[model samples]
Target: MHIVICSSIDFTPQIAQVAQGLTRLGHTVDIPLTSQQIIAGELTLEDYFAEKTNAGESARRKIEHDVIRSYFEKIKMADGILVLNFDKKGIANYIGGNTFLEMGFAHVLNKRIILYRPVPEMLYTDELLAFNPEVIDEDLALIR
Candidate 1:
């Protein structure tokens, strides 16, 4: 199965561990961003002044919207989604964050949902955690 590993880029080690487990079980995994990108400059917010100096605020907003839309299109292509654990900052406050939206989209589509965190603490709430969760099982049959 082609798995969409949805999680904050900061948790690369955790994602890699889960991905490795999935790979051993014959699944392909794809994560959105790298740990370096998250640490250096994850596009959490925009600077209107910077855009105003060049392409103007309107163009900047459009670009942001387009980028997010493109990402969702990519998520739609995945066979399943693996939601990781929230960091200390908490994923809840990051509502505009792409991870949350991708997870939500996957849920609505009724695709295979895999939760591969150390603990069951949720960033969204109880409603989001109602879906079936995947545990590490080497003998689990492949969906593909």
Candidate 2:
């Protein structure tokens, strides 16, 4: 199966590990562009986010638009998405705003939605559960 991983860019290392595991399983994996760039040292996570955080509204809009579109295209090309949900901000299996949006896209695209952990406890947890993502509980083999 071909899988596109969806997660916070902060989890680049863990995403790489998951991607490798999926690759070993004979599955083609595509990670978040930022994750790939960060792992490759082509991009610095802090600076990228810092710029976005401090940018003017228009600039931030443009940045977000470009990024969201790029990833949307990637998700459309893949067979499914592997959500690399990890603990963040004291929330176990955290799915932040962006990861949630990506999953929403995958769900709309009729792609398989696999979660590395159970649905998280967040404001949008109900909406996330509505997507019906398959929880694999960190078992890469269970992704498919």
Each model's TM-score, in the order given?
0.57, 0.88
Error of 1 at 129 (Å): 2.6
Q: Residue-wise lDDT of candidate 2 within 25-110, one digit each (tens)?
A: 99998887677777899878776677657858435644865878888998999999999899988999999888889999999999
What does the lDDT come to for candidate 2?
A: 0.86
Model 2 residue 85 distance off true place after TM-score fit, in angstroms: 0.7
lDDT of 1 by residue, 1-144 (tens): 878777655556666677777788788876654332333464422333354357566456547557456556656787887777544455332222456677677877777776544334455555455555554332235334
State the C-alpha lDDT per candidate: 0.58, 0.86
Question: Which candidate wins on TM-score?
Answer: 2
